[model samples]
Target: MTLKNFKVLGILLLLLAVFAVGGKKVSAAVEDRDVQYTIGVVVYNQNSPEMNMFMNYYREYIQQGFPVKFYFSGSINSAEDEINFIRAMKLQGVSGIISFYGQDIQKIVEACDEEEMYYVLGSGSISDEDYDKVKTSPYFLGSVGPDAKADYEAGYNMADYFADADTSSYIVLTGGSSAGNYMHLQRTIGVLEGLAEKEGLTYSEDVEKLASSEKTTVVDAGKDNVSITICPGYMTDPKGINNLKHAFVDRNYDAVLCTFNVDEIMKTITSKEEEQGSNIKVGAVDCFSMENHDEINDNDSFGNPKIDYIAGKYASMGGPAFAILYNAMSGHPEANTDDADSNTVRLYQGFWSASDKDTFNELYGYTQDIYENAYSCADLMKVIKAYSTDTTPDDLKALTEAYTVEDVQKRIEEN
Candidate 1:
């Protein structure tokens, strides 16, 4: 070939290379970079399956192959202790926080605001008053988890499972239904309302106050000699452990309807169920994991799965929550908060109900604790405004609502 022809070929290749690099630069997203964004995970308990799966999902979602890191705090109670923890996180170069703490959300936000950092609630929600106050703040990125309506339905459905049992005795293992816990309050009320409607009984007592009573109380069966013992407190502390044992020993109820994930707690008394030869049906709001899977598969003396009804969420549901906080820190503070008045991201995530072992096994595909949940790092990146500009808060809501066991199964099959 001639020298002129060879030179022309070289020039053509150089132009193509320039165009390729330019194309890459134009599509740059923050997720492509090696950025470090430290997030704080505020938890009530470090050992519970719910909390463990929750943090596991957040870690796999936000920490894997992204410019993000998570700094978890030990059990935080009052706002004062949490505020102090936030101060400590700031010194570690933490950029933002995702809190599962339920108490004094306003105070937690206030502390974040003071630190000049971004904040997001991993689960549960802020009060209407609290949302109105902090919704406009650039630092406050809104909240998620079941609201009062959802909580009520979750509890109602749990009790409704045993509606036709015709059992005269029932023991309710209420978790945190004590005063100041709105989630448990709504759940307890729903349980009572549902049990009454289906059990052919009438209740005139102030059951609503049972939510905020902060103590265990006996709900009047009202008719047919039914004794509904409302047992509050979990299976952890001494008082709570004693309460659990006493409820089983004293009430000898035929069924247990719990508002929280009581799979482990219930396992504590399987021997008692055997000794009494009780065919107790169990329902709880729990998580989608093998530990729970095993419990759902376990049978009592009557060959019934320890737990038959579960109103639960997948571990990966917490991913979008981190995405919201990351967006705020990315300067797209208005990415969510579709409402003009609230200016806060208010989204609802419903539960995945597994009424039987077959349903749970079909819904939850994992056989072990190495839970590679449905939402992968790539899926989580979709809601990240920095990565996907067109992604809206509405998208997060829809994703959360639709992330069912079937959804997980479909994702696994497709991949």
Candidate 2:
């Protein structure tokens, strides 16, 4: 061969060798991440940004890196729906389940136990009564969620914002508290307690009584007589919607504390604020949806941000939850428990709040798909037992507790 041809051949040979080595490495990586376990994810709604982000973390992010496949059971609310989903997943030979269904956990746990599927509470608490029954079950892995205190504080702080500003008149959306929703009960209490602390109004501490109170039950706040009508259910309840409409039309509420689903009344409140000159403020607990995100930045006719307070959660908050389940399913069950005597775990997560546009926009990237997710495989490796040997439940607990927007931002920046 000519010298020039030989030189070109050598260069081509070197490139071929480099490509071969790179291909082998990529193939090996794919082999290492081959699916070995199927995890069924139970959620109440599939349409919201919260659920979208949540499912994305598992299906797109986690599944891309781990030997896990996620099967989502879209929009299961009741015990029957949960039972049916669990049975179907069992028949599909799913190795485990991550349930977001808070209602009737005991039944769900028992159903999971029957199927011998490892179970975890993806979010929400296991009630004290239910906890006692399933805390020792072999199939019950553990739980991570915003506990009652977190829910209450979400309510309290939101209500406190309006109350501290001397906004006496208010309407409270009880979400599902009347239907025995645990999270709603706590938030409802927080709103009432927060208002009481600010306005010196007396209220029944008994959650059940408050949950069942007749609509338009007036709580006497010394000077203005703060009257709050608890609209029992959320949207889709014709009677509840009627009561809510009545409350809005009949009374001039200065603010509304929506413990769940702010969008339910956002339109009405905004229109009232703009057209009727109603100086109504809003605070609520919900996911970081774009429409609401904009409300945090967009001003109304009165030059005030439409949404004043939002106790929110980013989808990455659910990352460590999968980490916990991963440990349990991967033969490191010891790392899933907290107390030595208890077989189950309870990890509390915090909320990300935004009261103004700057505050909301500052943390906006975290909820969006772009921000290096806090619970990415590398980030979770710090807690995953197989990846980080000697990683304890405490490490996972710390991660769950550090789920606030500020903490997540600090973590992302630090990383």
Candidate 3:
């Protein structure tokens, strides 16, 4: 060959070698990531901002450099569909799943068993029967979220604070049987338990336990003891606010307890006030909006009188979910992964009260923060890395067990 041709040939060979090396490096990185494992997320609906924030954080911090994929079963409506979705994820060779179903968990457990895929429950607690059945599955990781019991504790704590010094009757408002979702039931139960624990309080078991009464002793013997009674109005619909208003107006109650949605509850109370000039003390759970805060502050709807009031709706689920899902994907099996009832399930700090704006800010400041900037995605990623590969059930348990109430409190405080 001529000298010029040989030189051209040599340059072309050099370029080919460089391209070959670069391709191998890229392939190696992809292999290292193991992105082949898809993670299925089954939420009641995909439209909630909270869910979006979580998934965004997961993508940015946990999956950016990783090879994990996410398959979301948006707006799961029925048990059979839920089971089918789990099976579909298994078909996709998903490494695991993170879910929060509105209905039952048995379908989820049974589906996981058939697929042999690792799973973690969030948002919903399992029934006793299902808990027993799924507690031994290696594929079932521990759950983490704000549970029903915590919600009830918060509700009762608010009631105690508002009624502690007053000797007057109060008004209570409920969303009726429709609001008897497991979470609401837990919160209501907690309130009842808290009231029962306090001295001088008795609930009429027959009247749906909506209200209670007690007589307070005055220091002056000449003065009579004041009889405080609580009367509750049940709202099955928004128009039921009229019924609630009538119940409060006709009855001799002092304060109002709203064990339902903050926005709707606030609207009903305000509407009633405008209609009948009522000033009932109100207490509710999960009132996070600024408008809700202003209404509580400006109005007498027995505003959150204590620190842990109105249990911060869904904001408490973010940190624990990041930690748990990471643990599952990293292959570190949690001991309680199999036992849904174990304390290993992380309980994140919720905005327990709305008595003060600053207090509210302390527990949850996300209302003002950007999705990505609000929390540490990298820290979440580290936890996932620990659990992604070569994970054992004991390892999973240890990690979950490490997340105690004290730890969560500290984390909440630090953040």
> TM-score winner among the candidates?
2
Question: What is the Cα-based TM-score of model 2?
Answer: 0.84
Which pairs, if any, clash in model 1?
35-67
lDDT of each: 0.70, 0.73, 0.50
Give a tens-digit lDDT track for model 2, residues 1-415: 7674465456444433543654411122234347677778877776655666577667666777777777676566688777776666666567888877747777877877877888888766776778888887888877888888888888888877887766767888887787767788888888877877887776644545775554645554445566665666766568777777777677677787888867666777876666556678888888666667777778777888888888867667778778888887888877766666765888888687887778777666665554466555777888888888988878877887788666776778778
Candidate 3 whole-model C-alpha lDDT, 0 to 1: 0.50
Q: lDDT (0-100) at residue 165 of candidate 3?
A: 38
The lDDT leader among the candidates is 2
- The sequence of per-residue lDDT tens digits that candidate 3 reaches over residues 1-415 is 7674465456434433543654311122244356655677776545444454455444444455446555556556777657766765565466777776635666676677677776777544655666676666656654665555566676677667665736244444444423345555555555555545553455435222332212111111121232323323334344555655556456444455566655545565555555565454556765454444455445343344222234454333444454565555655444224444442353333334655656655444543333322334432443454534444445433433333334445544565
* Clash statistics: count for each candidate: 1, 0, 34
RMSD of each: 13.5, 12.5, 13.8
Any runs in candidate 1 off by more than 4 Å, and if so which? 1-35, 210-216, 338-343, 366-374, 403-415
Ranking 1 against 3 by TM-score, winner = 1
